[model samples]
Target chain A: MYLCISVLVVFFQMELLTLPALRRMAICGGTHGNEMTGVYLVQEMARRQKEEGDKAWPVPLVLVLSNPRAMQECRRYIETDLNRCFTSAILSFPITDSTPYEIRRAHELNALLGPKDSKEAVDVLCDLHNTTANMGVTLIAYSPNEWICLHIYKYLKGKMTLAPVRLFMVNIPKNEAYSLESVGKNGFSLEVGPQPHGVLRADIYNYMKEAIELSVEWIGLFNSGVMIEGGEVDAYVFHKSIDYPRDPESKQITAAVHPQLQDQDFCCLKSGDPVFLSFSGETVCYKEEEALYPFFINECAYYEKGIAFHLARKTTLKIPSVRVQRN
Target chain B: MYLCISVLVVFFQMELLTLPALRRMAICGGTHGNEMTGVYLVQEMARRQKEEGDKAWPVPLVLVLSNPRAMQECRRYIETDLNRCFTSAILSFPITDSTPYEIRRAHELNALLGPKDSKEAVDVLCDLHNTTANMGVTLIAYSPNEWICLHIYKYLKGKMTLAPVRLFMVNIPKNEAYSLESVGKNGFSLEVGPQPHGVLRADIYNYMKEAIELSVEWIGLFNSGVMIEGGEVDAYVFHKSIDYPRDPESKQITAAVHPQLQDQDFCCLKSGDPVFLSFSGETVCYKEEEALYPFFINECAYYEKGIAFHLARKTTLKIPSVRVQRN
Candidate 1:
């Protein structure tokens, strides 16, 4: 009942504000049910702005409170994660035939948030999420075209605690035809952090606001037929694996250590401890390089092959300038 | 500028009402940019409702205006269809890449739209689209789960001109990993009509709005832990191509047809169509009654012959339900 009522209110409000020249931005929060920071942050911003007489709102922003059931249950989702389920197959779900509850809310939000015409306000989609293990910000983007990402990156730079690193994480394999790669344009996954408690709430809210501002500016540039600065970034791959003693009780072997680096920072290990090849592949012998590879081990897990171990190390590698490759 | 400002205002405004208890629905319009009816209809309804001074808005609807640039150009999308580019490889554009104007626009729209999340408001994601040649009200669904589609079908019945033939009209191939299917327990596509003049806008709006109401009711029923009176529908096979046609023109056969049949309409094609006996077979042929016939065509255009054929004519054959064979 509340969901229906809220949709109507927003739908009507959008009607009042409809005009050809209107600029619009759609903001998404709580993509993962556990990533509640974005959800809370948007709501708090709205509440505070209203209390302040709406003077703080700079652009027409559509704040979406996504995945209510997941939020309530504090789970990723009842059946599937909403963030990962944005495809045509959604139409097959009987519940989705008429518009699933979440889809309906998103639609209502989109209408209210999108620009009046295709040529008007810039269309922007911003999904906020937190990570379970990774500690920095990563923007999983699509296009190698820089104009789009640069605009967003400019705005998101300072507002976020960790500088956003943009990269193409996956390609549309022949098998997974419906993956986000299917969108193949410039979709991105904004991974916030390693589960920052309350920090993400504020950061995401601020990031969204900045993104809205940038969108307005970007749209104005487009309307005037101006080319924005910047180019596409290439995909960055971070494959980090540790070799555990095939035995469970034995401690993991130490390999050459890489210095700690910030997000986007990349280090090249030209020479390290002799590469001790494991069943999986080549891994730096941890124990032999302990002095050079100062590290802290997290909990260990047993995989099919061996006992897997996780560790945090430091590096002083330079962040490489990358280019996005569009398929 | 107006769009940006309006978005800012709405963003904050929606945020004000985005408390934990509020119900939400996400409605996506123009998944295929040419399907302007749903987009326009949603906008019109919101406009009319607001203009009429209706103080009470029924539901919190998030209207997603997908692919504005494509819609403006009256094309599905440039470079690549935005609908088909949702995979991870194409998520974000680079900071220095140069591409077509439409591709960049797609990226911008994605950035603006972001991903779906958990909030009370975003319970559903209604993707509205139109057909190229078929003229019917058919739903493309992810699963045949009746719990969701049955109610949607009920609400959609008699509301629009398109015939709601069955509970579900679509199923993703096992190989197709769609986002919506990956998210909810149920999902579906609301394929409106082949309206040439975009006259179906009103009907689309009415169906969508009514569907929202039905979805809300469903959420209520489910949340109350009440067992709704509906049997689960079995998963169906989604065949993109039954046979890989050897001829160029003959290859025009498509799966998206307006099936002209009553309730359970299916097809039973015999031995004449070209069949790739093995997974790696690259031959085409017309199936004769009981013989595995072969026909001469192009030598090696494709790697493997397709097991399916394009439906050239709209024929309603009383075919038995083919068991869904997983890929």
Candidate 2:
């Protein structure tokens, strides 16, 4: 369980292995305070990489464990779910005098990933997380517009049991929301499986291990390459669900594919409606007559958009916040 | 203009002032690289506070300017708007290793505000900026519920020509996107006026000067007041704009309000246009609306459900890495 804490304390103290002329790739696990598979996998990877020596990782690999304190506590961040705090206005934890352990880790990781002046420090970022419900191995690559993301995906597909996914939607028009859609960077939230699920963690670990290897291969091909085999992934079967929350503000104007049921669900949504369920064990209810109800196409789970659904609303939905161009 | 170039360099050099008994408040100006009014005011306040010889601010004030480089460059954080980088992931700027200057400032401020271990910091975050089109003073408080916000509003109103004017719909389902929305915390984004035109540096200076003063007062109340006065601004304005971005992964399932446009606008939007523009710029052509349109509400604008127009969007939005639950 003991691992190499990154040496450079100013930034991220990633378990380090130095390789000259090497590109560094950072893999983030357990971005969700509740999702800890990524943390477990990254820790394993860091341990293995450290053991295998620098040559084992063709590139320098930084394994990041998001919200370690939360991970230890088995919740997201202690008081606040750290995943939401990444907006522009709010970066670290909301601590005035003493920050929670998680915020301090975030600052450290941020500095290490991209030190104030060191542009060439960490090159690639891959965020690993798990879903509340059952999900397959997937990569959330929101950096399609960028060649770096494209190449990373290629490598990822080539190496891992990844299912290529089109980001169904993003939380747009809001500040500091992170996703492939928001930050045009090549980062994805790997929805391995439900938290504390052993099978899911194993799957996540294997896939991440492969991803690190492929990430190195991808970086190797960046500037100089003989054009060897690139990466390709399986089609990730997505469960058709809009992860948007039923907030009072959005609820007013949001034309839920089914407006009537939307309110009811928001007001009193239980569990097991159809599309998705929340980690808090809330089920979404829906009417069979609505066009978007049950959220399935021809009995196949479809991830047309990417909002996590805690409950089902009986309605046809147009996914919002998916395609904002960075100006 | 030779104010101290080293102010940029001295950013990290300053020791993190840790005083747990002291309430924590961080005021950031120039989040938008070009918005300098808050910066001017904060610096002046810092100097005056020093001159007044207050050993410790009534509250430990963490004064920060978001984008020193962009401010120096005189443009919104170009590669990536720094404001948008705080969410789940710090975005990758176009130029590799080129994080927005504001992001760097955010990191530095986060550290200084609370080193995570300090016990006395209060994280009273205020981001100050200037808007070019609007001619009003606005505060975007980060109150999660209605009651607390009303108190924040009342306190702010007494300090300035403050009006609780709602701006163009933020697509966030709830107020989670703003840093201040966290419970028991005071975070707000202040918009002064049309940048470089309406508010001169001196005018901004006055605004900043008073803000620092009011912040001190507010902190003192929190620290020692038996019964805090003016606690009535808690009626939550739940206005959801059509533009709210929805991120399903966050633990807080809140919705945002969107404005319902008229026939003149969104005419092309059929009953089920998937990615419809709920609140595009009023002045711009229908076809011309993409993201980042300048469609602020004009004079004699209607204020229904507490929504505003013509206000600029924060750089980005996402789930905070931490989640806090309130009793």
Candidate 3:
């Protein structure tokens, strides 16, 4: 009887830890300016807010366009990648006249929506992004154990019918998480694609809009004292990134993503599978011993970052269910 | 007998006018720097020339990288589009300190490959280009009556098994022709694509390489006194350009190319067909009375040019058979 009582007490404490009511949320877009779906979605929402007012949302929500200058020029970024400038170390850097444009912008954003890792930060943040690679709809989380993000991914996976929904965990520590989404207490990014930079596709734009709507709906249900149930979700955990083959002397790429592997993101790649095709008509094969899922294959923005594609190992995550804690 | 003799004399003169052998040919690439197929093909040909000493060609061939500064930066152009700076009026514009970099580069290219409309110009010039639209292997010509270009287009249609080959005529007068191709006596552009700017696709690259190789082979056959047989071919003549729906106040695009029309280049569009989808979920239909084929649909580069797509009217042209004129 004593052992049973101890087990019940442990379960009660775990539910207490999981049930904080989310009071405020933030949705950010244009972190990478050339990703048009997010930029337009944010604009669309702002227009709707002006017309309908905030009575539609159950929780207080803030909309952000992260990089206005880059969006104006239809470029990925103006000075440096804004999405990569949000780690605590970088955010704390002393401001100078010669500081990069994105770094300064990061500080202003942190002050607005984040203090990063503080209780005053928004309860949740969803930063919208797009990729040239055919990744479909992906929820990218900084931590595998982020229950709010994982539950949202599970909900989106069940709701999204136009394309396959996936969860990808970058698995970085909270303090070292570098994306704009990391500013909030429970943050993640929704990345969708095959959309080209500086161009908009209606289908892709629709998919993104649907995703944001569903995400907001899920947040509302959880905040309104509804018991949100969670279960096991399969996530692709990032392993490593591969770079394209390049000429040693000139540093120019000597090959392109092989036709067989192009647009096959999230497919298991085994050893000896074709990965790249040299400009001289030679096929370069994957050399890894173990089979792994590949994603973000041949992303246009990653060319400058020296990443051809990223490899990830699939793992199942367990999520806890709970109702909002009563004061 | 007098009537028959007059007809024979006219036919003889026409054959004589068409039979001049192509002595010097130029292959130019990188007029738009983000077009990887052209940039890489030029680099590959240059490397081959260094290795093989140009002994493989049937005539003197010049391989030109038209805009080196733009190519270096991987942008469409440094200041102004190099391809549009080739008309006689623009080419003859006196050099000034404030002249756009591409305009200055155009003068240098014209000096090397042309003295346009003169016998000193290269006999044939083939410019390579790429577009973000699904325009499968197009030969863009300045005139419908350029038999050399028509015959080459026919030959490519026969030889290219990977993609459909079609001819597109801009029909601009020779003196006012605004593209780089018009610098030579007989010139046309080999445009292929659906490739994103700053990204390379192996299949698209191979299609372009095969097209260039077949063009050079056709040149060799003609220069060696072969009778090149020709036939009637369908060509799309430029009609008009359509712009995306935009807000009057900010001039910001309010719509994207509808999903139905996104990659449907060369497909016939009827009046009242779906064309643009507004951010507010409204369908904007095509309002033209006449049915027309559309190309360059949602081209990323054309966003700044205010072109959503270009319409064309399909017309058939007759090509003439000819053998080299010998001294």
Quick one: best DockQ, which candidate? 3
Clashing pairs in 3: none
For residues B148-252, write the lDDT of model 2, one tens digit per residue: 233344556666653223222233522235232121144556665433311133333444446446656755754563334321132222232332222357421
TM-score of the second chain, each candidate in turn, equals 0.54, 0.55, 0.94
Per-candidate Cα lDDT values, in order, are 0.40, 0.42, 0.89
Model 1 Cα displacement at B101 (Å)? Answer: 6.0
- In candidate 2, stretches whose alpha carbon ends up further than 4 angstroms from where it belongs are A1-22, A92-95, A98-101, A115-121, A158-186, A194-201, A227-327, B1-327
- Compute the interface RMSD for each candidate structure: 28.3, 26.1, 0.9
Please, what is the TM-score per model?
0.33, 0.33, 0.94
Model number with the top lDDT = 3
Worst 10 residues of 1 chain A by lDDT: A293-302
Candidate 2 has a DockQ of 0.01
Q: Give the per-residue lDDT of model 2 (tens digit) for A64-89.
A: 77666666544444655455544445
The digit string of per-residue lDDT tens for model 1 on A1-327 reads 999989756654443211122244445666555564566555655555577653545445556666777665444555544554444454233444655555554333324433222243234555666542233455544333433444455435534443344343333432232222122222345654433221122233344444444544554443343333332233443334454333345432321112121111222222343323322123533343332221111111112123232232332211212222222
lDDT of 1: 0.40
